[model samples]
Target: MTTAPLVRRAHDRGIAVLTLDSPHNRNALSAALIADLTDALDAAERDEAVRAVLLTHTGSTFCAGADLKADGIGKGPGLLVGLIRRIATLAKPVVAKADGHARAGGLGLLAACDIAVASDAATFAFTESRLGLAPSVISLPVLDRVDPRAAGRYFLTGERFDTAEAVRIGLVTAWDEALDGILAGLRAASPQGLAESKAVATRSLREALDSGAEELVRQSARLFTSAEAAEGMRAFVERRDPSWAL
Candidate 1:
């Protein structure tokens, strides 16, 4: 039997809810999923009825970061960067309903959203440093959203943090038990007003990401193909510590 699609989208009460449905890989940033998400966002942008968007996921893990085991990692930086930038600059207001953990590049997705409502139980981390790589492309959005000192600490240490810390560091807008109120508030906005307001609010971020994306993508590609990152990926598959950890 054929597998289900990686992302599922539904529309209700002027809100377009796009869910990451690939629990098998914990919603990893595989090429297929990125493409599907882009399509969903594009459709939502074109739909006049979709005044807002809620970005959520199905599994306990919101996203486990890049699917390094998959063949797409070599070319994933561009796709992932594009998707994140799309979310950041999308005309409609996008809210992340983060009910689970987000790590590494996954944190970039959360940061890209205009508003993020995470559950108290949810967690976050920037785990790229642990893998002998840097969060280069993701830094565009992450840095814009997070506190500079906090970003530096987490980026360098690859430390895991809880929802409270995530909120404190500006990784999420707020922590809510349920997303109903947030969605309701967003859905109540006038479509044109919301769109124009969002455009104004995100101007600086959009310009920064657009100008820096090419360089960040090149850096990501270089690191992903580096000898240290290769060893890190190999060790991850072998269930052993990377050489740098020794």
Candidate 2:
């Protein structure tokens, strides 16, 4: 099978490195890219030679999020969700090496991992609200990683948050000057133990969401059509701040 151009996977030091490769577009998660990632993750999970997985990207961005051009929308496919679900449940650790802006769906990918290490320059945002779209698929993962009130603020505002704010909000586990050193430390730990711990933590959150799925959808539907949401989208397209107060 031909490898997808959007992702490249390699194994070394018992760690499987999955590099998001679409630098031209800041590694936007097009449907083809999502399909490739699903396959790559499945392969990594089945390979006993791989002890842990490290997700990173090639360009200045870790990921810019879903390809808005392809889908005319930002939601991920079932396979993408399944891949994230497996990352949470995997018997091996999954670490995110966030090197740049992890926006929208990209933030979802980081939250799905077992742990995340970001450079001092890394930035995060939940920008879908500004584009007349809801972060329906990524909402649960973001909520799990950050405080409820913080999630509400950022998700509603679609504002960019820096590394310090990301750390403060609990979106990332660590911020470091050298990403290599942090990955080295994670490599020294027991992959099995990390995997088990992540599974336990994420499973609980998933279960709670499952029980409240209906209410969640209803709320999002309401927000999607709200006048505020319309203004947000218009402001974004017009390249001006939203006049929401008016």
Candidate 3:
């Protein structure tokens, strides 16, 4: 595990900080990372001392979206759904702490968190449309958090925005500040209090995930399997423009 990129560290303040340490791929949500994150989240939820969960990353980019070049990319949509769901529905409050750029599905992960804070310099984009895919499954949690009008523009344009814009659009809770204070507040609360209050706070989002996830999964599978998406993803890996980028 010494060489593994995913780092799990439990703070004495009862916060489980899960770092997406694989900066080689900009911590792309590969199958392995997804599995590791899901397992870690489950463990945190069950840990008696864990009052909350903090999801963060290393390197300049929080996540570069999916590992477009991964071996099992075909199975990614379902796995992504599960990973996002796990974070959203975890018993404890989940907070996102980012000091880097996040794009595509990475934004989905941010939206699923109960609270998300990012550095003032961080940026974000919903690049799914450019990849010949839609933020279908992620839209479940994302739209729930984001302003409908702002989500419409970003989802369609796939344009990048700054952290201040992210906060304005409701994509993130705030610009990065004293996260220790936030964690301390959680630690001060009874675990059951935090859990139950979070449940109340996220009830609608959880329902949206549960009730709407199936069709979105099918939509994601269909889009990801399409020839258009293949070219887009290939172009992305090639660091070139897709054919449709005229």
By TM-score, the best candidate is 1
Query: Which residue segments of model 2 deviate by more than 4 Å?
Result: 1-4, 74-80, 177-186, 212-246
- Could you tell me the C-alpha RMSD of candidate 1 in Å? 1.5
Candidate 1: tens digits of C-alpha lDDT, residues 115-225: 888887688989888888999988988888899999999999998899989889898888775478878777777877888898887887798887998998999988888
lDDT score at residue 139, model 3, on the 0-100 scale: 93
Q: Evaluate model 1: give its lDDT.
A: 0.87
Q: Per-candidate TM vs. native?
A: 0.95, 0.81, 0.94
Give stretches of model 3 more than 4 Å off: 1-5
Indicate whether candidate 1 or candidate 2 has the larger TM-score. 1
User: What lDDT does candidate 2 reach at residue 70?
Assistant: 69
What stretches of model 1 exceed 4 Å from their correct place? 1-3
Residues 1-246, candidate 3: write the lDDT tens digits: 355646556665688889888888888889989888998898898888888999888889988788867744577877888987787778898999889999988888888889999997689999999989999878988988999999999999999999889999899987778677788788889977987898898888888878988899899889988999999888987999999998
Model 2 lDDT per residue over 1-246, tens place:
965467899988778898989887788878887777777778888887787788888988998876756664334444346556766667777788887999887898888887787887788889977766677767767778888899999989889988888888888887855556756765777767666766777886567456654555565556656788777767876899777433
Model 2 global lDDT (CA atoms, 0 to 1): 0.76
Clashing pairs in 2: none
lDDT of 2 at 72: 42
Q: What lDDT, from 0 to 1, does candidate 3 have?
A: 0.86
